[model samples]
Target: MKLHGVDYTSAPSRRKGITIASGELHGDVLILESLTSLPDHAAFDAWLRQPGPWLGAFDFPFSLPRELVEHLQWPTEWAPLMRHVTSLTRPEMRETFKAFCDARPVGGKFAHRATDFPAGSSPSMKWVNPPVAYMLHAGVPQLLAAGVTIYQLHPGDPDRIAFEGYPGMVARDITRASYKNDLRSKQTPARREARERIVGMLEAGQHRWDVKLDAGDFREALVDDGSGDLLDAALCAVLAAWAWQRREARYGMPEFDALEGWIVGA
Candidate 1:
């Protein structure tokens, strides 16, 4: 099957665009074919519309926390809720989520999807730090517009299935040491070594998925990027390969809130 793992950015530019690792699954091995960059929204939209009998694991939250959604009284269903969220500007979203966090006790600030704890992910409503909220704002609408079927939530193109994927979860399974920094000055040899170690583990099939990666000549680029975008995409590809193996069994997903989507393999 054609498979992809995407490392997404809410704001795309020449410097920090969305990165995709594309491959094909042959039996249990995922052969990495190419890495592509979408440096702008137009490019991303075009890529989405490309005919696909492909499955992808995307590194972005698909929906909001149920508690946060109920508290805001937004539409509870998937499509309507996304439309409502899209109605608000990023600053507006930040203010709304900020207000919710401000009223709660410290250490219990953010409302979480049940999957967050298990997946060890940032809350989908969090607007700063990782700024995943902005990611959801920018990314999900594209998926909806593209007519991709979001597993267990919304149905569109049956051939183009999307799953919520966490590259951090996969990376941490190898090591918790920091492996990426966006600033070139801060991209140290130590971090490069960490990326190499992570790549080595993938080559050896040491991750939770137990699926080895055949990265071919892409190995050096994956290690040298130091931003971790390439490696993150590869990690998501691993998760996608794992999920594909269990496609007949609900893609390895447990019972989860349809509105608050689950991270695949969590």
Candidate 2:
């Protein structure tokens, strides 16, 4: 199947934004074909509507914490909750989430999903640091509008399956070296070395998914950028390819809650 891994940003720009790693899975490898950077959410939404049979692993949360939702007394159903979330502004969301956290204990300020532990993902309601809350606000509605099937979440067009992916899970598993960063100062030679090692591991099938990277200049491409967005996108692509190979096995994703979706290959 045609596979894509998207490294998303809530607010994209010409300097830094969404990068999609596109490729096709061969017998036991994913051929890294090309990388495309989209500058804004509108462009991403348009890309989602392009006619094709492709499965993508998007680097964004598909759902919020069920605990948080229940605490807020918001719509418990997936579709309705998404609608409610999309309707709110970011400041409004921040205030709502802040109030929720303020009422909770210090050690448990943020609610987590069942998949968060294994995936090492941030709380979906977090508005800063990674700002995934904004990503969900920007991305999920577009997926719904494009009629892409979201695995165990709301189903639409099956051929265009959109799975949640965490590149850190794979990167952490592959090496101890820091591979990519958003800050230019942190993108050091050591990190580049780590990226090389990670690429080598993936090529050697060290990930144990029975997949390898097709022979190419992928190593250079993965480490060329300091922000690590490109490498992360590539990792997500590999995860997407792995999931496609094991599509019958539910892509190694656990049976997740309908209101809190699971991350594929986490």
Candidate 3:
């Protein structure tokens, strides 16, 4: 089956954009194919709508915390809840979420999904820094509109399955070294070394996904991009391959709240 791993962005540009690693699984190995970047929302939407019988692991939150949704008294069902969320502008969402946090104690500002702990992911409601809340707002509706099936969360076209992915989990699995920095100034030799290690690990199937990389440009591409977007997308691609290998086994994802979807490789 066709597989992809996407490093997504809410607002993308030519310099900073979404990266997609596309490949296929051959027995236990995931053959690296190509990496494509979509620098804007229109490009992203067009890619999603492209004819696909493909499964993808996307680096974006698929759902908000069930507690947060309940606290806000929003619709608990997946589709309607997404509808309500996508209706608001980013500023409106920030204001509403800020109000929610303001009413609570300082340490308990954000409600987290069950998957967050194991995945080491930021709370889905976080609107700043990683801005996963905005990512969800920007990403999910498009996926739904494109007719992709989100496992355990929303049902759409069965031919295209979308699973939440966190590349950090896979990166940390290989080493604790800092591998990437979005800031050009922070892309140091140590980070490059770390990237090399990660590439080597993936080639060797050291992450225990039983998948090896194809030799050539794709492998070089993963290491050459010090920003780590390509590598992150590659990591997600490996996870997608793992999930595809075990498609009948629910992709190693645990029982997750339907409203708070699980990360695929968490």
Candidate 4:
């Protein structure tokens, strides 16, 4: 399988270490690494205007859990729900999701959708641990700005193709929930073992459901001299590896089209 694609970037971001599967990924498979940590509305607006190979993003929380959506009495329908969500301001989205979470039981803090767990998605609204609600705030507007469609599991659109996959879900499954992400936690021997094992799986061609991860390809590299960038793309490379490893069904047989979210000929 030839991995042909272009990275949406301010600079060439691919790791100098990457090998195997080299072809330009269609220009739209974007790279949205935050330029300034918390990019403002203007920068975001500017990014949106550009034509994209990026259809959507690997959102931490592509959608909320079913229970949470019901709890807030947010629009149950997809089109209306997306419209309503985008209508809200940053603070508005945060406050609303937070209020809904606060009212729930402790173990089950946030309401999740069927897609959430399946996608191995982080709770977009979670206050700590990636706080994907911010990702939603950061990402959703870009989707809307591009007018790219999302692969939604909502009422009308059951067979949509999404740009961002909850690859962490796939990552966790192959590795199990053993490897926690924080710095101190990840350095432990046990976590190292877990990560190594995770690496082993990729190298061995284990998780056939995701794309080939090709972990060994970049294990020795430091950084890209040309781009001075690699971490985010490396992460995405990992995502693509896992995605390549997966069985096609895991993509849920996503549909790619203008209405489905891809920019035709863009």
**Which regions of candidate 4 are displaced past 4 Å?**
1-57, 152-162, 177-193, 208-210, 215-217, 221-266
- Quick one: best lDDT, which candidate? 1
The reply for model 3, stretches above 4 Å from the true place, is: none
What is the C-alpha lDDT profile of model 2 across 1-266, one tens digit per residue?
78999999888999998999989998888899888899987899899987669999999999999999998899999999999999999999999999999999889999999989988889999998889999999889889999999888888887788999988888888886778777888889998888888888888888745578763766687767888888888889988998988888888777778889898886
lDDT by residue for model 4 over 104-208, one digit each (tens)? Answer: 788887765444444555555564565656655555555455454454332222221234544344446566645433354344566556555555564444663
TM-score of decoy 3:
0.96
TM-score of each: 0.99, 0.96, 0.96, 0.58
lDDT of each: 0.94, 0.87, 0.89, 0.42
Model 2: lDDT to the true structure: 0.87
Residues 111-146, candidate 1, lDDT per residue (tens digit)? 999999999999999898999999999999999999
Alpha carbon deviation, residue 70, candidate 4 (Å): 3.2
After best superposition, candidate 3 residue 249: deviation in angstroms?
Answer: 1.2
User: RMSD in angstroms, all models?
Assistant: 0.7, 1.4, 1.3, 8.6
Give, for candidate 4, the lowest lDDT window spanning 10 residues.
Answer: 257-266
* Residue 11 shift from truth in candidate 1, angstroms: 0.6
**Model 1 alpha-carbon miss at residue 190, Å:** 1.0
- How many pairs of residues collide in model 4? 37
